[model samples]
Target chain A: MNCRQARDLMSAYLDAALSPSLRQDFEEHLQECPACTAELGSLAEVVSLVRSLPEKPVPDGFHQLVMTAVAAAHPAPRAAKVPLWARFDFSRFGRVAWAAAALVIFFGLGLAAGRYLFPASAGSTAYVPPSVTAKPASYDATVATGGNTVTDTVAGIGRQVAYSAKMDLQVQDVRAAAAAVSSLAEQNGGYVEESKITTGWFGRVSAHVKLRVPQAKFQATVDQVGAQGKVISKEITAEDITASYVDVTSKLIALQTQEQQLLDLLRQTTSVDDIVKIQKELEDVRAQIEAIKAAIQNYDSLVAYSAVEVNLSRPLFPWLSVVWPGLGGP
Target chain B: MGPQSPENREALLVQRCQSGDLEAFGELIAPYEKKVYNLAYRMSRDAEEAKDLAQEAFVKAYLALPGFRGEASFATWLFRIVANVCTDALRKRRQQEVVSLGRQVETSDGEVMLELPDAGAGPSDVLEDLERQHAVERAVRSLPAEFRLVVVLRDIHGYSYEEIASIAGVNIGTVKSRLNRARQRLRELLQDGELFEPHNVYKTRAPSKGGAGR
Candidate 1:
């Protein structure tokens, strides 16, 4: 080490922080260079003198002063025996009877008030409970363009429903009917989820096609598929999933908030153990966030695609096939 | 619990403090009051402010007790809070006190007089040791808070570089560089204030703004 290098390493040298080779070089330089050696000596003296400085006694009543501030801030500690009292005090038959009666009376009064205040909440049933006032915020608040599902209708909120339809129809030719249904679904921005066709010995055919269309075109697609053959039976159902969707979405937002809070807590600690503990909690929060995200994505997918099942069959009798058009056949 | 170990006792005290027991909180902070006060004094440079900052540190510690899982010893955790509460309190004020750094002292006379005490000159001719110590304390307090922290922790408190790094939330390399720069600045201050026996025999020019020292 040269004089400049020695000066840089001198502090670490006195602290015994230098590597063996560097220490050797440092000593070699110091032996030849008096100026650097003297400078190092001065630095050492400063360190030692400061270390020798007497510790100032805390001012009188310092502890009392701090404790008073602390007490003012943290006022009360419930006796640790409270839990024990809770466990044992209810064991007496008379006390338990009184407690049960009081609970019933309190609940009855609360119900009466609740009924008076939110009369419509009970009878005008919605998918989400009226009591759950915390609105389910959008998963991604930036893009909320889909006019109606849970993702689009949050906070200002409306029900999120998934619609599906099943139809059994009679057609002159089941194979041709299935292809027409597939084309119709595709034209409506959807796909044929599943399609099956079978031929009987006498050329009678039956086909089943499951079509998935975007929710916006759900009713229109259903009407078109019904027209593919004479509709023998048609069933359409809407499943309200607002409660489950809202529940999952709320959990997601909460977990994200906790993740941020954990990150802030991690910054306040320099202890390796504290960092590790907080990181573990952060990891768990991250995992839960991802899981909730996936669940919301699944909800979005179900709401986006409305399922339509079309079953088409050629009549067993050739004469019945003749009147297939506009005929509700067996 | 017949004569519990210090760690066990501290753990109990912390547990009770977390449980909202004010008395336990008081006991927990009593032993650290002197050390905490001195550090607070170092950062604030005013006795009244130091007292307030020390109390604030304890109050903050009390509020944060639930999160203290004994990862670091109670003393380490508490002193970290002392450093934080005091430094944060001073940060805004420090930003406004833009005194010239060691790098900025205009030594126009070209007399590079560093107050590094010569080996031959003992403490006899200069001020009394106590007076010199007070000067050192003033010089230390004058150092900008960041540099002052490493100096106080390393030189005054005898904390290891690693401990300083942990408390200051900086790496060890930062701790080393900060100590070197702070001590260099302090040497200049002591010499400029005539608090040390200047190595007069072979004095060079004043340290060029920033270039002469590390």
Candidate 2:
């Protein structure tokens, strides 16, 4: 073998790890090459020198020491004894009996308190006293236009709810569609609450609009605006806020009266600094009164008009199915 | 039966031990404790550590007695477990401190002296022999743990290659390779004049086998 090959197998040859044929080849090389043979001899010597060291026996009682340690650490059979003790006294804990009785009494008291606080939660009572109101009839038909669900009414104040349905239009300009929808709301005597445009990759743009329309023209505006593009999805929920609005309106009147009384007190004050402080306090009260009035007015506006949120996509990907609630099958 | 027919007795003890007889297990371990401890001591080169490792090995074997497949002798399996435990102990010790081949001589007066080879061996014939033996022991201790283990099993303990492989978790070829490397290393570590000297134990062999020289 060449010097390179000999070096590669030298370790294995020194280890006596070569196969018979390989061993033969290595032996032939070693016979021919003095340097490799010397190297092998040195490696072998190193291995043997390491192996010849005398072994010192363990000290006396070592087994007992280890076994005692293992016994202390593991103690396997002790666990089995626990079950035997448990079998002898299943209810040995006297305190547990008292605790269990206390738990039962506490649970009973808690149930009684819950029954008194939330009487409506108890469905077993069938007594309909005179204080209770009459049952209302359920809504039958729904006008499923755009993404809004409008219910039919016969006599009671019609609770109209409107919501905008966003869709991707296949048109060239999305801004034009947004302007058209805004104009339609204005023509219906409706006002736009919020509108914004967001830019996309490759000069694409999407428009978002929140608008309010009178309850009377709610369905008509939705139908007119929905004709713009593919409707993606919409959700509409309406609440009968007539009673809540009336309550708030009455509260607002009370607040205005309180503000007027405060103003009168401010005017009658004699001390200069006190008058200034009272006037400041009166102005604060008046500000709160105005805020209350505005809130009531806003609620009235919502009750009178319906809100629609319209999201317009740039129609980047077409030929995709769009399903909107109340716009499809039952 | 041959004087070495402890096999039948061992089998009986093993059966009882398998049945969870503690006394039987003690009996089973009693005879082999010295051998196991010596093997562990050789591997770890520490008396106290060897004892602990050997005991743990036996206990592990005791717990696993039910699963002992009788394909190999229980001694063979026990030796392997001790070897592995000793190897681990030695590795842990190496990590803790560097181990040199410095001699630790114990005197009859209960004194211990740590000295180098030349220092312990004064320029006298008796000291020379002791130094040579010490040198051989130091060389064996210097071997890599793997080759050293094979030499201990083969030469000192006289376990066959198959038994060594079983204990070492290696094949017979690996066992042979380790043995050869260990022997070669031992030979080199010996003074050149001492390499050709034979072991006294081989003197009893027939002439058909090469005559052993000392």
Q: Output the number of the DockQ-best candidate.
A: 1
True-structure Cα RMSD, model 1: 23.7
Q: What clash pairs does model 1 have?
A: B112-B205, B112-B206
* TM-score on alpha carbons, each prediction: 0.47, 0.39
Segments of candidate 2 deviating more than 4 angstroms: A2-23, A36-330, B1-6, B99-121, B171-214
CA error at residue A96 for candidate 1, angstroms = 35
In candidate 2 the C-alpha lDDT for residue A40 amounts to 72
State the C-alpha lDDT per candidate. 0.72, 0.61
Report the C-alpha lDDT of model 1 over A1-330, residue by residue, as the tens digit.
678788888788888988899999999999999999888888787777677767777865466556646755764434445566567755566977998989998997777567656655444221221121222222233323333222432354356777778888888877778899999888999988999998768776788899998887887888788777667777777777676676566655566667878999999999998899789778866776666667667777667788899889865643322323233244
TM-score of chain B of 1: 0.76
